[model samples]
Each structure stands twice: as C-alpha cells, then as structure tokens.
Target: MSRIAVIGAGIAGLTVAAELAAAGHAVTVFEKSRGPGGRCATRRSAAGPFDHGAPGFEAVTAAFAEQVQDWQRAGWVGADAAAGASRLIGVPSMNALAQQLASHLPPGASLRVETHVAAIEHGAPAGWRLRLLDGQLNAGHFDAVAVAVPAEQAAALLAPDASLAEAMRVTRSDPCWTVMAAWSDAWAAPGGSWTAPDPTGVLDRVHRDDARTGRVALDGIASRWVLHATPQWSADHLGAAPAEVIAALTAVLAKSLGVHLAPPVHAAAHCWRYAQVPDARGEPCGWNASLQLGACGDAWHGAGDVAGSRPDGVERAWLSARALARQMALSLTPD
Candidate 1:
C-alpha cells in the first residue's frame, strides 16, 4: 500500500484521509490546531457555546447529502430540532463531525494534531518527505500528498517547489470576522439564516441558535447569535482590537435588526483572514501530479454565495481529497 500524508485536518484533509485509508492505503493527517474541524469549529465561553466558525451546513447535492447521511448514521451530526428546519449541526460542537469522520481510520491510518508541516520535499527515489515545523523529522515514502490548508499558507509551504508554488499562487481566498453573542433574552428572525440587504451592511449573515430545530438547548434563558461580517469590512478592520471590532459589529447588528440593544452580555470576535474563495479557475478541486500537491476549498467550488453555501466548503475539500486518494491508489498498486 502507498503511504500518504494529508496536510490540514480540516474537513478536506479528514475526508481525503478517510477515503484513502478505506482504500487500504496508509494515511496520516497533520493538523496545526489543537484539534480538528479547522474553519468549521466551535468555541466555548463562560456564558455559553457558540459555533463561531461555520454556523451550520446544508446538504444540497447528492454527494453532499450522502456525506451528511453517513455522518448522521455515524452519530457525528444531528438534524436541528427547531421550527423551520433545513440544516444540520454537530452535536455538542462542530468538531464532532470531524471526530466522527476520523473514527473509522484503519489501524495504519493516523492523525497528528498540533503538528505543523514546515516544508515538503520530493525525493527522486525516496518519494515525499514532510518536515514538521518543530524540526522533528518524520520520513516516509508517500505515494501522494494532499494539502488542505488555506491558499496562502499552502503557497508559503510549497514555495521551495516552483511549480507547486505557482499553482498555489493562483488560488486566493477572502477574509471575514465572525462575531458571536450569547444573549439573556430570545430573538426572532424571518428565517434561520438572515442576510442584510444593505450593500454597505456590516453584517453579512446572522444565525440564531435558539431558533434552530432539534437544538439541544433552547432554554430561552441563554440565546446564541453569530454575526458574520462582510469580507471587505472584515479586511478593512482586521487589524483593529478584537473588543473594538466586536463592539462595532454588535452595534451594527443591533441597529440593522431595528433593536437598540446594548452590547451583548458576552461578545467575542474571530477573524478568518482566509475565510472565503477568491474567484479561482478550475473545478472545485485541482491537483498537480508533478508536484504531488492538491488544492481545495469553497473558493474552488463556488463563491459559496447561496443560502446554503457552507456545504460547498466541505464538498470542495472532499473532492480534492478524493482526487488525490484515487491517484495514490493507482500509483501504489502492484505492477
């Protein structure tokens, strides 16, 4: 079997690793974070818990639906038990989905969290060697490698290789600020997801947790809201202090909602510098065989501009991982 190294334990990386392992190939995932879930993560606070990253996922296409079904069957995700239901979220937190995807990894399949890949070198005879940022060298002759990191980070890591660097350079992503609030009182909206019609609006989308169906807790005593800022707005103010950004966005959210509410009881802001896609070419996934590098993300899929655009993020990552796994499977086959 071929040894494969999947970089970035996000949905894309995890999906690829699972597929490759199921195909009998040895797979290893390296993640820079303390845990999996990447952009689709949840953060816990003294006030409550909020899915600060991806608020929820929608299964549009058959492929995405199948994936969701599998996750649900595996008990990784659950349908929200709220009013007008049309989405799914991870139980307890978003990371549960990633954790479940990784559950069935073969004995040879492994994941290394908090390990940052410093650089990758392709040896003519020895195959691919991945160097960790901590200077701990782990050598393996991988038949293939899939990179699921943001385009900019991927570009930096693959800089030593000209062709791979160029491929990454062409991939770009946008940034945004996610403001999370846990309120003491409940709030109602027309739908589970709301987009401000104002072009110059500070908030792009707002999700009310209590309004979602099948939600674990909607005690009305605690309400969670996520405010996603426009990419341009986030970019312009990314360097500002976190508290200041949160306060400003909280104000904008209050005014936009036509409610003169005070700053949320608990408010926090997270900045995703590479949050969305950037008008890239090709399909939802791309691979460079010569460089043994693959790229994927929502940007590669669509602009993720639809009502249920978050699923595209997982879809793009899975597509890229699947492409690489198939290639590795072929290459690792006995002659």
Candidate 2:
C-alpha cells in the first residue's frame, strides 16, 4: 500500500483520502483551517447558523447519488425536496459531510488541521518533506500526493518543482462575495431562487429562506437570506470595508424586493478570494506522476458539465474529486 498525503481538506482532498483509504493505502489529510469543508462551510450568528460557504449540493450523476446515499446511510447527511427538487444537505451543518468522510478513516489516519504547509521538498528516496508555517517539519515517504487547494495556493506550494509549478501556474481561479442576513420576518419571494441576468451592480443571486439545514434554525418569524455578488463586483470590492458592502447589499436587496425592510438583525460578508474556477481546464483532473502531485477542482472540469450550469460550486467540486479519486485508485494498480 502506498503512503499518500492529500493536501487541503476540501471536498477534493476528502474524496481522494476516502478512496485511497478504501484501497488499503495509508493516507493523511492536511488542512490549514480549523475544520473540514474548505468552502462548503457554515457560520453561526446570534439568530442561528447558516451555510455561508456553499449554499447546497445537487445530486445529478449516478456517482454523486451513490455517495449521497452512502452519506445518508451513515447519518452524516439528510435529503430534502425543496420545491419538489431533490437536494442534499449536511445534517447539522454543511461540514458534517466532511466530518463523516473523515470518520471512516483508519484509527491512525492523520488529519492535520490548523497546520499550514510552508514548503515541500523532494527527498532522495522520491518522497516528500513538508515545511510547516510554525517551523515544525514533517517528512514522510509517499508513493503519491494530491494537491486539492485553489490553483493559486497550489501553485505556491509546488513552486520549488519547476514542471509541477508550471502546470499549476496555468490554472486560475476567481473570487466571490456572499452576503448573509437574518430578517425580522419572512419576506415573500417570487421563487425559491432568484438570479439576476444582469446583476444590479451589487448582487448576483438572491436566495430567500435558503438555509434549510436542521443544524441551526432561525428563531421566531425571522429567516435566513443570502446575496451572492458577481465575481466582477467581488473583485472590484475585494478589500472594501465590510460595513460598506453590507450596506450596499442591504440597500439593493430592499430595492429588489420593493420593501423597506429593516437593516438585517444579523449581517456579515464573506469574501472567497479563490471562490470558483474562472478558467477551468478541459480535463477531468490533473496529476503529475513525477512530482506525486495532482490538482483538481470544479474548475478543472468544465464547471457547468459537472451537474448543471446553474453554478452549484460544491457539487461541481465533489464531482471533480470523485473522478480524480477513481483515476488515482486505478493508477495505484495499473492493469
């Protein structure tokens, strides 16, 4: 069995770790965050908890459905038919999915969270040595390693290796801004989902009562709402003051709904610097056998082709991870 190190605890990393472990390979996952679910995350407020990262996941493919079924069986996820359309969400929070995937790992399967990988070096034995941000060094012999971070972050990690760095350099990603709020009362929306063909210079998609997960429910009549800003707008206002952005989004939301809604009882803004794949490669996934590094994300595969063109970022990332895992498994024992 190969010793594998999967970088980043996002869906891609989690999926690959599970696949490798299922194949009897020794695998470990390294994440810089405090918990799993890199972008597919949730946040808490006085009102309640809401998924400020990935809104939800869509099960469009047989593979995705099978995984969801497995998750449901494991009690890590729950199925919901929103407006008669099927979707899956984490039981308590979105991160529950990642937590469940991490659960089945072998007793000693290492998951290093809050540990930053500073640099990676190739050893004489063709293994990897990781230099962490805290100056703590961890070296291991691995038959292969997969990098499942954003293209930019991946590029930085592989910079010492010329070819691998070059491959990552070709990959690019964009940013996004998600504005979350809790209203005093449920506001009537025409549909469950609303998209602006031409964003009104502030918001891209407006979702009403979107946080349907059971983890944290909005109290009283107040419900959860979200406004996703266009990538262009997010980029332009990447460093703008948070209060300013919140004010702008609140005003736009009020105008769009044609109601003088109170300033949200709870307001927050999330900036996804590398939110989604802007220019996804035409391949299903990428691997550098020599460097023992692979790169995959929703952007690696055509974003729209993963599930639908509607931009379900988490589901797309999951699809790319699943495909990459299958490929990695095959590579382990080539026929």
Candidate 3:
C-alpha cells in the first residue's frame, strides 16, 4: 500500500484521505485547527454552538447527492436548515460532518488535528519529507502528499509545480464577514421562518441557527441568529476588529429586520478571508503519477454541470477531492 499524507483536514482533505484509505492505501490527514472542517465550523460558548462558518450547504451533483443521502441515512445530515428544500446541514452542528468523516478511519489510516505542515520537500532518495511549522519534520516517509488548502496558502506549497502555481494565482479567494447573535426572547421571523437570502440590504443571508433541525432546544422563547454579509461589504471592512464588526452587524441586522428587537445576550463576529471565488474557472485537479504528488480543493474543480446551475463551492470541494483520489487510485495497484 502507498503511504500518503494529506495536508489540511477540511472537506477536501478528509474526502481525499478517506477515499484513498478505502482504496487500500495508507493515508494520514493533517489539520492545523483544533478540529477538522475549516469552514464547516461551530463555536461553542455559553450562548452557542454558533454556526459562524458555512451555515449549510446544498448537494447539486448526483454523486454528491448520493453521498449526502448516505450521510442522511447515517444520521450525519438533515434538511432542517432549509424547510422543504434539499439544502442539508450537519446534524447538531455543521462541524459534525467533518468530525464524523474524520472519526471513521479504518485500519492503516489516521487523522492528526492541530498539526501544521509548513512545507514539503522531495529529496533525491529519502522520498517526501513534511516540514512542520515548528522547524521539525515528520518522521514518516510518505510516498505521496496532497495539498487541500485554499489557493492563497496552497500557492506556496505548490510553487515547484509551475502549472499548479499559476492556477493558484489565477484562482483568488475573497473575504466574508459573519456575525452570530443569540437572544433569550422572541422576534418576528420572516414568514414564521428565520431566513432571508439575497434580501434587501448589505446582507447576503440571515439565518436562525436554533430554528434548524437537530440543534439543542432552549427552554423559553429564544433565537440564535447568524448573519452573513455580502462579499463586497466584507471586503470593505476586511480588517475591522471583532468588537467593531459585531456592533456594526448587530445594527445592520436590526435595520434589515426593520425592528428594534430584543437586545442580544451573546454576539460575535468572524472573518473568512478565503470565502469564495467570484469567477470559478473550474480547473481539473492536479496529480503527477510519476511524482505521486497531488493537489485538490474548491480551487481545483471540473464542474461539467449545466450552464445555468453550476455546483456551489461546497460541492466543488467534494468533487475536486474525489477526482484527485480517483486519479491517485488509478496509479496505484489494488489489493
């Protein structure tokens, strides 16, 4: 079996690692965060589990849809986020999906969280050496390495591959500002549901976190709201302090709802620097069979879907990861 190391434990990393492991290759996933699911995140606090990142996602492609169905059957996904719609969310929290995927590593496969792989080098005879952020190198000699981080971060790691580096340079990621607030009182929800996509003002999406299915219930009338600002707005205030961001968004929320509303008991703001690409070129994944090195993520996707309805960012990540795994498997002999 080929020994492989996947950097970044986000959806792409986990998906590729899992697929390779299932194909009889020994794979190990490395994540820089305390947990997996970079954007599929949830912050735990006294007033939380706030879905500050990737509130929910949709499964557009048939393959991803089938996979989503499997996740639903396995009790990892539910449609409570968008009532009567196919939009699905991780049960309890968005992070659960990544956690679930990372948790189920069969023999010879493993996951390592909170580990930062600074760089990778290909020596003449020693194979691939993973350099840690702490100046130490991973002891294991992996036959292959996969990079599944955002384009900005992947650019440096993929510099040796001129084509991949150019692709990364072309695929630029934009920023986003998200504010999550919680209250202990009731508020007027839009049409009795708590959501507004492409509504009227500076916001792109406003969702009621607690209103989704599988979330822990509150005793009295309460609300957990998550507000996602438009890409332009987020970029304008990309470096704003969290406190200032929270205050600004809270006011915007009140104005957008056209209600003074109850004061929030908890509120916080998060910035996603690499949130999306305004124009996704839908590039194919990177794989060098002779080198056994590869790269894949939302930045590298080949969405052949119909013109009008292309796959979203989340779906692109899965597609890219799966494509990379399939290519790698084709190069390796099966047991």
Candidate 4:
C-alpha cells in the first residue's frame, strides 16, 4: 500500500482519502479546522446551527446521484424537496457528510483534524515532506500529496510550481458576506426562502432556517434566517468590519422583504473570502509528475453548464475529488 497524504478535510479531501483507502492504500488526511467539510460548513452558536457555507448540495451526474442516495439511506443526509432541484443537506449539520465519509475509511486510512499543513516540498528519497503551520515537519513521508483546498490556499502551498500556481490562479472565486439572525415571535417568516436577482441589492438569497431544517426553534427563537449577500455587494463591502457588514445586511434583509421588522435576538456576520467559484478551466485537477503533487477542489471546475440549472459548488468539489483520486490511484499502481 502506498503512503498518501491528503491535505484539507473538505468533501474533496475526504472523498480522495476514502477512495484511496478503499483501494488498500494508506491515506492520512490533514485538516486545518477542528472538523471536516471546508465550505460545506455548519456553524453552531446560541442562535442555532447555521448552514453558512453551502446552503445545500444537488447532484448533476447519475453516479453522484447514486452516492447521494447512499448517503440518504445511511441517514447521513436527507432530501429537502422544498429546496427544489433534488437538493439534499446533511441531517444534523452540513459537515456531517464529511464526517460520515471519514468514519468509513479503511483500516489503513486515518484523519488528522486541527492539523494545518503549511507547505509541501520534495524531499528526494522521501518523496514529499509536509511542513506544518507550527514550524514542524510531519514525521511520515508520503508517496503522493493531494491538495484539496480553495484556490488561494492551494496557491500558497503549491507556489513553488509555476504551472500549478498559474492553473490555480486562473480559477477565480468570489467572496460572500453572510448574516445569520434569530428573530423574535413578533416577525414571522415570509416563506422557506427567497432570492434576489437585482445586481444592486445586497442579498442574493435569504433562507429560513426553521423552515429548512425544523430545528431552529430549539434555540428558543421564533425564527432564524440566513442572509447571503450578492457577489457584487459582498465584493463592495468586503473590507468592512464584521459589525458593520452585519448591520448593513440586516437592514437590507428587512428592506428586501418589504416589511418593517424588529431587531433580531441574535445576529452575526461571517465573511467567506473564497465563497463561490465563478470560473474554472483546463482540467478537473492538476498534478506534477516528478513532484508528486496534485490539486483539486470546487474551484477546479466552473459553475457547470446550463447556468442556474446546474450542480452546486459542493457537487463540483465531489467530482473534482473523484477525478483526482482516480489519477492518483492509477499512478500508484503498476502493471
């Protein structure tokens, strides 16, 4: 079995790790965060669990649809018919999908959370050496390394390679200003969710957490809403402080609803610097023959064909991960 190191614990990383492990290869995943599911995140606070990263996932390919069905049958995810487009979300939280995938890794595979791999370098006989954020190098050498992070993060790690860096640079992502608010009983939700197509508007979509998951009320709030600012608006306000962004977005929310709403019981703003992938080209993944380095993520593929009627970012991540794993597996084995 080949010793492989997969960096980042998002869906892409986990998918690669699981695939390699199932193929009888020893795989170790390194994640910077406390948990998995990079962009497929769910934040829990006094207000409740907020799906601030990706609202949900939709399958475009039949193979991915079958995987989603497996997740559904396994109770790791559930369908949200109200979301339309066969959208599905993690049962307890969006990260549950990543966590579940990690749990099923083979005996030779393992995951390391809160371990930030700062850099990767070729170590001659050792193949690849991982430099951690704490100025220490990982003791184990790997036959291959897969970078399954956002384009910016991947760029930072793979800066030594001009071609890989250029490939990552070409794929651009947009920032997002997200507002999570818990309302009192005074104001009721208008509906499950709403999207604004106006370019000038601050919000692109507003989701009612209570209606989406039926779990927000447990936080002792009447209703909860997640307000996502449009790409242009988020870019315009990207430099603003968190409090300022929250205030402006909250005002925009009420205005967009065309109702005079009271202040929320709880409100907070989160800025996702690499929120959505607007452009992607070349291939589903990038790899170096001599360096044994590769990159893959949602940013590898564009928003998908057919515009608004295509798969979401999470599915792109999955597809990219699968493609990367297939390449890595083929290379590691010989006839």
Expressed as tens digits, the lDDT of each residue in 297-320 for candidate 3 is: 878654544454577777788888
- How many Å off is the CA of 86 in candidate 2? 3.6
lDDT to native, each model: 0.71, 0.72, 0.81, 0.80
Q: Single out the weakest 10-residue window by summed lDDT for candidate 3.
A: 191-200
What TM-score does each of the candidates earn? 0.87, 0.87, 0.93, 0.93
lDDT of 1 at 86: 52
Deviation of model 2 at 297, angstroms: 2.5
lDDT of 1: 0.71
Task: Find the number of clashing residue pairs for candidate 2.
Answer: 0
Q: Of the candidates numbered 2 and 3, which has the greater TM-score value?
A: 3
Instruction: Indicate the residue-level lDDT of 148 in model 2.
Output: 82
For each of the candidates, give the backbone clash count: 7, 0, 0, 0
Q: By TM-score, is 2 or 4 better?
A: 4
Q: Which tens-of-lDDT digit does each residue in 32-123 have in candidate 1?
A: 88888888887877666777777766766666778778778777777765523556788767777887777667667899888899988787
Tens-digit per-residue lDDT, 221-254, candidate 4: 8777788998888899888998898888878776
Cα lDDT for residue 57, candidate 3: 83
lDDT for residue 259 in candidate 4, whole number 0-100: 72
